[model samples]
Target: MNHTRDKESILQLYNKVLPKLAERIYQNLTEVTPLFDDFRLEKIVDTWTKDRNASTDKEISIENGNVQQLGLKLSLIGFQAAGAQTFDLSKDLLFSLDYSYYEVGPDKNSRWMEKPYFEEWTSKELDDIAVKWSEEVIDEITQKLQGL
Candidate 1:
């Protein structure tokens, strides 16, 4: 296998491969994100009146993606005690994960750029999902590039 030739092929693969992979990852993440039904809704609102439902939703997206990099954003609204009333930890939260990829021999590799900015503010399930996403990116990319 010629090194330069392999490089060119990998470059070509990026345009064809990354966008599809990104879409799948985005969908996988959004499907499992929480709606905050488990949160303490009773304490947050004036429960003395009627049923105060603590509604929440996630704003998830594949922010950017190309040959060398991919970025993802996850924002939670109405998931906390404050229920979007303020920007503090007791309210809403947001974070981003970035992955960079490269070719090594006939395989591709990916890694997250850094720990999420609001990692400590998030739940264990969310942390696990983020880790899974990073691992899935490298595994899937490697499988796709194995033939090249």
Candidate 2:
């Protein structure tokens, strides 16, 4: 088994695999994400309104009965090294996420970059986990989507 060959295969898997993953994760989240119902929505509005710490007031938007401006962004990066003559090739993957949460601060309003999810994972470990999660979720959602 050539390790260099394996690295290429895995990289190809992600390159080829991720478009499907993104589509699935997005569609699944959209379908599963629920708007706060009139009852639950009050809780959400209360949560936002309780946010009195405002150096700057910001207008909020609602969409499909849910907060439209709920914020977060995610990214994944990958790298690989061909194995030495004596070793199998290796790969390193990073799963990076950026997002802010609604939290009150000194002035009662603040949102900041929460720690990236992959802090628990090193660069190599993160890629591996991200790929695995993507693959598993994709398969699971595909079946679920088919039913829907």
Question: Which candidate number has the best lDDT?
Answer: 1
Please state the error at residue 96 of candidate 1 in Å: 19
Q: Lowest summed lDDT over 10 consecutive residues: which window, candidate 1?
A: 39-48
Residue by residue across 68-95, what tens digits does model 1's lDDT show? 2222323333333232322211211111
**Model 2 C-alpha lDDT per residue in residues 90-114, reported as the tens digit of each score:** 1112211112222211111332122
Would you estimate the TM-scores of all the predictions?
0.26, 0.22
Q: Where does model 2 exceed 4 Å of error?
A: 1-54, 58-121, 145-148
Let me know the TM-score candidate 2 reaches against the reference structure.
0.22
Among residues 3 or more apart in sequence or in different chains, the pairs in candidate 1 whose N, CA or C atoms overlap within 3 Å are none
- Clash-forming residue pairs, model 2: 53-107, 53-108, 53-109, 93-127
Number of colliding residue pairs in each model:
0, 4
